[model samples]
Target: MAGTRRIVVIGAGGAGLAAALEAGRAGADVLLLEAAEQVGGATARAGGVVYASDTPVQKARGVQDSVDELINYYMTVSRHELEPRLLRASAEGTRQVIGWLEDLGITWNPDRLYIAGLEHKPRGHMPTGDTRGLGPAGGAMIVAALLTAVERADNVEIRTGTRCTSLLTGEDQVVVGVRTETGEEIPADAVILATGGFGAGTEMLRKYWPDAVRHGDWHWYLGPDTNIGDGVRMGLAAGGELRGRGGTLLETPNFGRLNDAFTPPWLIYVNKHGHRFVDETDTYCVMPHLIGRQPEGRCWAVFDDAALQKVADGGYVDPYGLGVDLESNWTAAMLRRQIEAGVVTSGATLAELAARTGIAAAGLEATAEQWNADVAGGRDTVFEKQGTLAPVSTAPFYAVELRPAIIGITFAGLRIDHEARVLDTAGRPIPGLFAGGEVVGGLDADVYAGGGTSIGNALVFGRTAARTATGGAA
Candidate 1:
């Protein structure tokens, strides 16, 4: 009891759970705290893809990816702004961390390869049988496995609905523990801040990430309700530096929760003036970046009955909206439900659809005519859209307005070092203070690589933080 070290993990998401498991397994007394009623934060709601280099799945499938390639891709995509040391650690340790998950009884689905925003290769590793519905099934599977492992660990204590309101620091401003909302104090030898970014915090978005909040009142969050920058606030109060607090991972936007579901490939995106912008088949990261350049961060998805029926006929759009045979993340049934809810408007004619969606009828009709011609000619003359072009002539026509929204974790939080230690404004590590996941920023810059990047960061750094906190091999 006297020699036992206490490790406190805040936010019981992927990072917190992984950190608690590793620390507890390493003979430390671990306390995993969550503000929610259960674990599985944004990770459960995510696509469940963890981008890793040199994974066993990659080897078995002959993926031919190397850490150098991964870093090159990361640097290229992130504009060489990602911290070099953190990037190297993540690239080198991803395969081993994935092995750790495998050793914990987590199974991989080797059938599918996801290459959304991740460039050049298929580095996404997912759990077996994780595809169930629109939500990420692999993420739920991973969380369930981690929860079971944590439950069986005698050294780990999980306390849900206990929000860490503040960080407690000792002499020299070294973090000692955390204080909960009800003024409950939980002391620890080391604290791991796994609490996610500020996607839901309007004030925090306004104060720190103004670009994320600049798009009128239309911008919204697709992350969990718990991601209100709790870790960022606590870290800032404890004098930790913030980084990458400018941009986020978003999509073609939505009207309230109308278009919050996955984007379909065949659906046409047009701006207010009813002109197609960007190739629809562009990657997820590219789509949002393209959409953000449009006037007022606005766009609209126009689809016809034929496109809808194509989905009804078993053709599927993958998680990143690429055409595939797998289940459509946004199903036809969901579309019908949205239609019934009036979030998606349908019309018997193009002009009627324009009237319903507030777009000019003349421009809408012209756009539809060009789209039909493009589909018939087997090429898009305007945007040069990839894949087989589909005509939107079949009625009734449907339209859904798009407003820029955060579809993933916010890209700003407490800054940390290569060892996962929270750093101060002076760039010095705060002793006994560490962070991981979305809470520890600088892994990304203006652009998001994809879904797996966030998951990979959480798993790799969460494990690293735990080992470092325990004074074990990192």
Candidate 2:
């Protein structure tokens, strides 16, 4: 006990669990703290994909990819706004973390590898098999596996329902311990902040990203409510600086607050000017950005009575094959019900539809005419939409307003170096203070790079922070 290093990890999410496990395995005493009663944070409610390259899974699947290539794609998507050193660490660490997680009973089926980003190569590695009744499979499965491993580590102790209020710094402003809301102080050799993003914090949203709350009542968060910028507040008080901005905002119809991510492929999304903005089948990562660039940042799902009538009742359009069927208001019965309730706007013609939905009439008419021609010709020349092309020709047209208001992940927080050490305003590492996950930013730009990058960064930096905090090599 006298010679061993004691590390206190706040927020028992993916990053915190990985840090606790890594430190505990390295013969360091770890105290994993969680504000919520449960252990998992946003990681548990995610899609559970880990984006990595040059891994055995990709190799086994006959996909030759490299970390350099992945970094290049990331930088290109982020417009070179991300730190190269941290990106290199993330790309490299996540590659090895695949094997590490596999060693901990998480299986990566080479067959499940898919393209999760803009890259042509497949780098998104999804876990195979059931989650053993641990909530929904993806992120829940990953969380359950990490939690089980952490529980088995003898040097690791978990304390939930404990909220850290502030940091205790000794001479030279080095973090010595954390003070809980109840006035209890837990001293440690190093403190790891992994409280995730601040999507649920309205004040932080107004201060950091006002656009996140532009729609007010229509805007919603898809993460845990505890992600309210506590880590950012404490880190700022501890002389830490913030980095990065914006986050992933999925397009939502706000129909009964359903958790569905994708809509039926047959529906076309048009901007307020009645112009199709992007491919109807693009990933959720950049859909919001594309929509945000439109006039007034308003989007609508346009369809005809024919397509609505042909809608099946069983399952909505899920091209991703992620098995995420929480709720769907797209069924024919539901559509008719919403249309009857005036929730789904309808009109007898394109002009009437545009007038009712506030879309430009000429643009809507042109788009419908081109769409009908594309459908008849069996090709979509405009957006090259890969989904089923349903002609917008019927007695009545329908339009369901869509908004990119569902906040998924925030990208701004404390600044950290490549080794996962929190940095001050002068870019110097804060001694005895490490941070990971969404709490540490500068890893992304305005647009999200990939789907699994968040979870991947959590595991990569979490382990790296533990290794560095324990005075060991990563």
Top lDDT model: 2
Model 1 Cα lDDT, one tens digit per residue, 1-474 = 899999999998889999999999899999999998878887766656778877778778777889988888889988888887888988987878777778777766555655646486778776653322424456766777677789999999999988889998999998999999999888999999999777888888888777776766657776678889899999888899889856554554343353233455587888877888877666655667778787766788888888777676442444533222344324687677678888888999989988877788888899999989988988888977666467989999998876556546677888888789999999999899999898888888877776578888898888889999999988
Q: What tens digits encode model 2's per-residue C-alpha lDDT throughout 1-474? A: 789998999999899999999999999999999998888889888778999999999999899899999899989998888889989999999999899988878888888898888888888888754454545648777888899999998899999999899999999999999999999999999999999988999999999998899987988887788999889899999999999999888887777665555656789888888889788778878898888889987899999989987888764544336664555767787788789889899999989999999999999888988889999999989888776789999969999898888899999999999899999999999999999898988998988888899999999999999999999996
Candidate 1, lDDT over the whole model? 0.78
Stretches > 4 Å off in candidate 1: 129-136, 213-220, 246-261, 309-366, 379-388
Judged by whole-model lDDT over C-alpha atoms, candidate 2 comes out at 0.87
Give the Cα error of residue 376 in candidate 2, in Å: 2.3
Model 2 clashing residue pairs (backbone): none
What CA RMSD would you report for each candidate? 3.6, 1.6
Give every collision pair in model 1.
253-403, 254-403
